[model samples]
Target: MTVTPPPSRSAGRVATAVERASSALGRLRRGRLLHPAGRSFVGETVIWGTPGPPSGVALLDQPGRYRTTVRLSKGTPTPGSWPDVLGLALRLHHDDGRPFDLLVSSSGAAPGLRNLPLPRRRFTGTYSTITCYRAGRRRLWLAVLADPDSVDLGRSLATAVAATRTDTPRLVLAVASAVGPWRLVGQVSLGAQLSAEEDAALAFDPVRNLPPELRVAGPLAWLRDQTYRGSRRARGATAQSGGSTATTV
Candidate 1:
């Protein structure tokens, strides 16, 4: 698949500058810049093959397990609270030394549900991105379906990584698209969780570590760099100010 190049270098620089300015303002008001104030955790999950026939997308072609780390946060930095937008950032490591990074925000799961006001949710709720991947000529989205009664379990998965200590709870990664209905594509099982400090230092950039097959498109893709770049600027400012440290959001 042919992926379009990112925004021009000049546009990127301008976006980065705007992001730095926003970080500066955040720093001035809060005394320290917290790019994203949300719960973070690490786990292990398998990206199972799509049900039925092959999708023709090389990355979505088979059963694959990955060591995963997820940073869950709100769109607005609400302290210990959820809001209109839910940000779920994923980094997957494979056995062949390749890494897959995906950053998606929860808006609406279905095509008809697009742009509708999202209800408030906690750390335990399911998060999804609408139509993110390209499967040959088709577009699709991935969702992490969480159990209704699994709120505490979800939080626990983030705090510690011990595979739930009993039954290894499975989370489904469903792929959906405008052309077709949702399809079960992959599964994730948490093995270990990252420490709070490690989580704080983790950087989740879909662009930097993403696989070649999964490229973000549309206007949202252009704005993604501004976010990472701004968070980076904020981290630098915080370090220079001798305040608390952060890596990315």
Candidate 2:
């Protein structure tokens, strides 16, 4: 079957991100997401992931409805190189008048939502990308989004990241679903402009924040990375032994 590959994200990353975002949203909702009215947040968590082919390391999860791809390619393609695989798990839930749900949450960041820094400004209504350097082991030189005159992008992002208590996250959810209609209740919506009160409240949400124990890349993530590296080493060994295996994501 020919996969359309929505948003350039490969299969693996999409599932992981969606799962994380969904779970986090669920925990935070507490029956608060669904409202009595028809209006709702532009985007919110709705469905969890469905299973896919049982591949190595649970990378390619298939919800059938979602479009996923691999983020990291085999070789170091480019500096700002968006991986062949990424995480694309969003649906255009609403498009009545305004395009509000520009970015939504995913599931893998569960219990923790994937957030992209929104430019705080009186925007002229133009989409723009910002080049920034992340200071961490990954030290990723990635693109961020912001407004023309929004100088507080960094601070806002820092506050949000600090609110969630997570390290620099690579993928920010651009769209997602909610348990019910958040707009109806006039409650918190995933894509709504967060107020200071809402930010403060979410900063401490048990589900929104990751436990200190799971703070850093846990053993599983480490294992996945190490195992990936080890596989490369093993491949090298095989190459030396005059045997070969073609790796594919």
Candidate 3:
């Protein structure tokens, strides 16, 4: 049997430093360091199963529908008409009632560029996982593409909020290998808007909330977990001052 070695002491030290810095920033901001301001909505996710090769994730291999909560935000607080990295976070419930969180950000759709975040003027652009997820022996990436039938969303956060007020926003959920084309696997339809308090109280951690078949591995996952732990701890400490401490899913 093949065994993976543990991270080196130097790597561990760097991860620790990253956790500490992230914790401090989370405390300073009293919320998310990136994507502080966002809009949340009640949504539904429908899986159609991929038409191409099996993704190895049962959720995407079989057809299913689930209730979901979605959050859309900008990575950097850019003003009106300015381009900024957009974020899309989805929270879904597993069959056994555990939360499955999936977070993606505006990024390239091509092979070499998929991991790179790209500033987008509109919320209708593509959003990528940025990191690959392990599905058995294979690694795959996920993405969300705006449905062509959906209304055209503008550049500003306010515009997106306002547009969703009147129109139901729809997105296509797709998956692919590192250098493969995206294959449609599901659809996401967002409905009613969530209150500011509700939005603020929502916290997403993909590292902890994923399914067994689809694992987030590697040193990057370790770093991500630490960062998320630090942020959650810092925010929990000051939860009473702002949003509720209760995490929805």
Scored by Cα lDDT, where does model 2 land? 0.21
Q: Which ten residues in a row have the lowest lDDT in candidate 2?
A: 180-189
Candidate 1 residue-wise lDDT, 149-170, digit = tens: 3324433223323335444445
- Answer with 1 or 2, whichever has the higher lDDT: 1
Per-candidate clashes, comma-separated: 7, 40, 0
Model 2, 1-249: lDDT tens per residue? 111223444645654554445435434543112110011111232222222322111111212111111111112111222221121111222123211111111112211222222222211121211111112232111111222332221222223223223322222221112221111101111232233332212111111112121111223232222332233232232111110011110
**Candidate 3's TM-score:** 0.89
- Poorly placed runs, candidate 3 (over 4 Å): 1-6, 10-14, 237-249
Model 3 clash tally?
A: 0
Would you list the clashing residue pairs of candidate 3?
A: none
Q: If the candidates were sorted by their TM-score against the true structure, best first, what order would they fall in?
A: 3, 1, 2
